[model samples]
Target: MEQGLLVVLNGLVYGLLLFMLSSGLTLIVGMMGVLNLAHASFYMLGAYLAYSISTVVGFWPALVLAPLAVGVIGALVERYGLRPVHRHGHVAELLFTFGLAFVIGEIVPLIWGRLPVPYRVPAVLDVPLFALAGTAYPAYRLFMMLISLAMFCALFAALAKTRLGLVVRAALTHPDMVAMLGHDVPRVFTLVFGAGCALAGLAGVIAGNAFTTEPGMARSLGAIVFAVVVMGGLGSLSGALVASLLIGLVQTVSIGLDLPFYKALSALGITVDVGGRLHDLWLLSVNRAAPVVPYLLLVLVLATRPRGLLGSRSA
Candidate 1:
């Protein structure tokens, strides 16, 4: 029971981090209708920037400056790379972002080398915040959860309450009408893209210590993100949030579980008298299969709800 509880808690923390990344991606897609494939590259950039700065100065400075730098990079990409591509169509815009991801992937290794950088949690947060049933929960993970939650709240408030958010919401649903009213659609699109990339950067920073900060981190994460966004729907921010949390929990919990579905089937159904490595293979599959749970969920979600859960029907 205690172990199960810890696993569930960890799932929640990871889910929040995924939400932070997905929130921005969803908003960008929902509002601008552009599928920015380079989103995860921003995450990798954030981790690298933090690692570099922390080495030069300290973790504190890196935390503050890395996201800011990434935001600028995202803004510049929007101004130069994406804007020109946008004129073509959403598919072309997607391909443009995809190309950018590969470029960033190559550039990261050039700048930081192929090895994973050593990035530990700050000394202040190195120790666990508290113990749960003798299990120590690291302070950094707690801090990450809090920060992600706070960001989500702020984002929700900004999108739902503020005047700027109202305009964004309006444009997301009806860009043509909003433009007809003389609103600067281009500026809004750029800002939304920047904001989305900034969120990805922030997630990278938080996850860097928890996971390894490697040049290829973004390459590993980018596809899962696309799956999350697509599973959530094209333009629904709420759907993105829900989908992220769901995937996060699914992935984390699946790892800690030992369902051994195939092995169980041997006992329930007619037993295939497997000998030697076959038995061991089934045993190994129990653990190895857990890692793929989120992707399976993504496929299932896409298969069933092409529009995604809680996704906006239009725009």
Candidate 2:
């Protein structure tokens, strides 16, 4: 029972982290219709920036400075890099962001080298928060959960209850109308994009030390972020939350289980005879297959609901 609870807690932590990373992309894509392929690069940039800033000032300050810096960079990219391409349609926008991601990928290695940095958790949060089933849960993980939950609440309130959110949502579906109402629609787009990137940066600042800060970190997470977005629905924040938690729990549960395919099947009162290559495949344990589970879920979700769980529009 304790082990199961631990797995669930870990899953929630992982899921919330995924939401933090993907929520920005969802906002940008949903609001502006521009798929920022370089979104994950911004996340990677945040981690690196936090690492550098923390080395000088400390983690608390880096937590604020890194996301702000990333937001500025994102705003600049939208103004100079993305605005010109906007006139050319989505294909052009996609190509530009893809190339931008490539450039950032190359530049990171040059700046940080091909090594994992020592972005360890701060000493203040490095201790155990509590014990469960004789196992200690790290306080940092709880801190991450708190931050993620707080972000969700703030973001939800902003979009669902605030004036700026009304303007942004209005601009999304009626840009000409919003522009005629004395709003700078283009400026709104820039702010939305920057805000989205800032969210990604904040996730990086928190997750870097929790996980690892490295050049390939973005590449590793990039695919899963897309999967979460697609599965949750393209523009739905609520959908993202549900999908993130679902994927997190699924992956965690898979990792926690040690049963092989045949044994798992037997538990359901089914049996299969296999041999050679097929036998080897059947012998694979659930834990060993954990990495593939999210993609499988993605495929399943896409096959069943093309619009996603709570998405109003089709992807």
Candidate 3:
């Protein structure tokens, strides 16, 4: 029972982390209509920046500053890298971002070195928040939950109740119409791209210690983040929130389940040996299939709703 609860807790954390990363990716894809493969590279930049800054100052300062720095970097990329290529169409944007991803993957290790740099949670946040059924829950994780929740709430309010949100939606759904209205849509796009990258950067800072400050970590996890955005429904903030929380919970609980459902089936007169990676031959299919959950969700959701759950209603 305790184990089950713990799994749920961890899953929520992971999902939130994914949401933070994917929300930005989904919005950019849906709004900007640019599938940036380098989105995860921004996440990696956030980690290395935090590591460097935190090493000199502190984690809290790094958390606040790194996203800002990454945001500036994203804005520059939008102005120079993406804009000139905009006229060439989305394939160009995709290729550009893909190239940028490789560049960042190479550059980060050069700047931070090839090691998985240590990212200690702030000393104040290092202690356990509480123990549940003999399991200690780290305070930093709880802090992470709060920060993520707060960011989600702020994003929700901004989109649901503010002028900026309405403008962004108008731009996303009707770029030409917004421009006809004299709005500088390219500016808005740049801002949106920067904001989205900022969210990814923020998640990188929070997850640096909880996960790793490694160069390849972003590459390993990039697809999953993209998967979450696709699964949650492109450009839908509510969908992103729901998908983030749901994915977080699902991944967490599934990975920790110990029930060997397949292994136990023999007692019930059903038995079969599976052939796959030895890593996947588990009694519990959830544990075996843990890493691919987001992709599965992405495939299922896209099959049913290609525009995404909260995507713009096509004319």
Arranged by lDDT with the best first, the candidates are 2, 1, 3
Report the number of the highest-TM-score candidate: 2
Tens-digit lDDT string for candidate 1 (66-107): 888898899899999889878899889989988998999999
Model 2: which residue pairs collide? Answer: none
Whose lDDT is greatest here?
2
Candidates in order have lDDT scores of: 0.83, 0.93, 0.83
In candidate 3, where is summed lDDT lowest over 10 consecutive residues?
A: 274-283
Off by over 4 Å in 2: 262-283
Give the per-residue lDDT digits (tens) of candidate 3, residues 239-303. Answer: 77777777778666657655565664565688666554553554555576767766766677678
Across residues 1-315, which tens digit of lDDT does each residue of candidate 2 receive?
998999999999999999998899998989888778898999999999999999999999999999999999999999999999999999999999999999999998899888999987999999999999999999999999999999999999998899999998898778999999999999999999999999999999999999999999999999999999989999788899999999999999989889998887788799888565689978999899999988999889889999988898888
Model 1, residue pairs in steric clash: 30-235
Q: Candidate 3: TM-score?
A: 0.89
- Estimated TM-score per prediction? 0.89, 0.94, 0.89
The runs of at least 3 residues in candidate 3 whose Cα sits more than 4 Å from the true structure, single-residue gaps closed, are: 261-285, 308-315
The RMSD of every model to the true structure, in order and in angstroms, is 3.6, 2.0, 3.7
